[model samples]
Target: MKCPKCNSEIQTENINIQADIAQCNKCKNIFKISENIEDVIDDNFIVNNKPNGTWYKSDFNKTIIGASTRSPIAFFLVPFMLVWSGGSLGGIYGSQITNGEFNLLLTLAGIPFIIGSIFFWSLALMAIWGKVEVSLDNKGGKVFTGISTIGITKHFLWSDVSSIKEGQANLRYPGGKGVSLVLEGAKRISFGSSLKEERRYYLLRAVKSVMNKNR
Candidate 1:
């Protein structure tokens, strides 16, 4: 581009973005760039798909996404367990399951039933006493999943995140897909997507909105 005063050409390569100033090669004239520093703290983050009822908080620069296993499935399991116990105790309970008459082989043969019981019970336990949370900022993010204060946390830099999109898990459950981050190094990070459908999309869009503002 030509300098306004001397009409001498200036190379675009030498411009400083943050400094917002450029120097003319011939005249040594320093001129300010028209660019302005932007602040990402705004309501734009929530205008997109907002969650129906999951917990959320944002301090503008830092966004926190979280949910407890408070799904109705938790409540549903109560009646289910009651009905199962009522039926199972009538005959099968004393007859085989809680009875010493069943041999080790028979007990061993019911491993599938044991596993299924454990799965359902675990789900109920988590629903009553578990939480999953994510903290996102301009530079990095963290995901926490656990019961109460005990759980695992995964950390990642925003630069390492290639993209955020909806991803399907290998499981065969409904709403198995969730917002996931694709890393530059061929790894994937999922923030416990077993949440409701509204929360899933809200998380996807919020992450995208924050990352876009940083850009």
Candidate 2:
């Protein structure tokens, strides 16, 4: 096969699946590709993300990468969650023990507060520690995003996917952008908007390149 970047003859020995990369001797450009290098889009694309705070993984397997969902609003919500959860739980348990009885009216009144607290607290924590992992495997793609094992997973083959591009970001967080996967028709799945631009672009390119390679 010819080098995608330089269009020069590439020796078969230079293409090694185990290495997951190739270097063009003519232009001295490096790239990641499958056996059919010609089908690769932007073969010379470089991923510069490295040592990026707590989420950095020097050994970031190109096939699988995670984007964190951390947000500045989460930090602001920390104090609110503490006070809200304390009040909600304290009222429920205090009434139960003080009256020596689980008053249905008091319990019902506290339930909504408890639920709200839990929901917001969970969202806050997720914003702090949650991550979405995108993988290029199986028929097309697989995505898992969550706080630990308690998140969600999505699976879809390439045939079912129509477009992979940048998606809308949550307006609450300014300057945030997300990656969206549009299915064959109207269905769309979006994730990882809070990530940095370079990270999002890498994900978009990785998926598109693999998809083209499959085709």
Candidate 3:
């Protein structure tokens, strides 16, 4: 097999009865042979080393729950409905005051404002429930946020990742949530917390594992 780090030929040396470490003879690098290599490796039984720099692929299908799911109702729908109802009520009041004829200029001005509110509200709703897809490749990765089936994709180099920290913290936007991940420097580019605790632990471990192997 080829060494993931340097694309050199990897040779396995038996370390114990049940374990063997794959070492790259050229680069003098070693990585633990994972038991789940079948799922992790590509069609050729080599790790998925795509053009982008990610050693693994993780797709998060986050269910819209809590406040993030309700933000449309609270921030957009409620306010728009209230404003529209108020405008209708105002038009009726103005018509009554003007002896059965509504003021055309007042009603016309309100119409545009109401329409603009609807547009703005729809955009806000779109922003709330948007599905964000984050892809990490060999070069880099990106967070794609939108309602369309295809999510956004971003690319970054391995060197661009300054640091990887692991911990639990409450997240914003969706709110009332805690997440864990191998953070890249100060920027929170992707959602790491969605992974199961064990999976997340391994993900963080994998980041450190690759980093140590590269170093």
Best by lDDT: 2
Q: How do all the candidates rank in terms of TM-score, highest first? A: 2, 1, 3
Per-residue accuracy of model 3 over 52-125 as CA lDDT, tens digit each = 22234333522111111223334655566567756664565556676876676766666766676665554445
Model 2 stretches astray by more than 4 angstroms: 1-46, 49-62, 168-187, 193-202
Candidate 1 global CA lDDT score: 0.60
Give lDDT tens digits, candidate 1, residues 87-176: 544344355755557566655655665566666666666666766677888888887867776777888887667666666543322223
Q: Can you give the TM-score per candidate against the true fold?
A: 0.58, 0.63, 0.37
Q: What is the C-alpha RMSD of each candidate to the true structure, in Å?
A: 10.2, 8.9, 10.6
Ranking by lDDT: 2, 1, 3
> Which ranges of candidate 1 are over 4 A from the true structure?
1-50, 60-62, 82-102, 127-130, 150-152, 174-185, 213-215
Model 2 Cα lDDT, one tens digit per residue, 42-147: 5444234322422322232336656676767676777788887887778787869877987888788888888888777866876788776777654666777788
**Native-to-model Cα distance after best TM-score fit, residue 166 in candidate 3, in Å:** 6.1
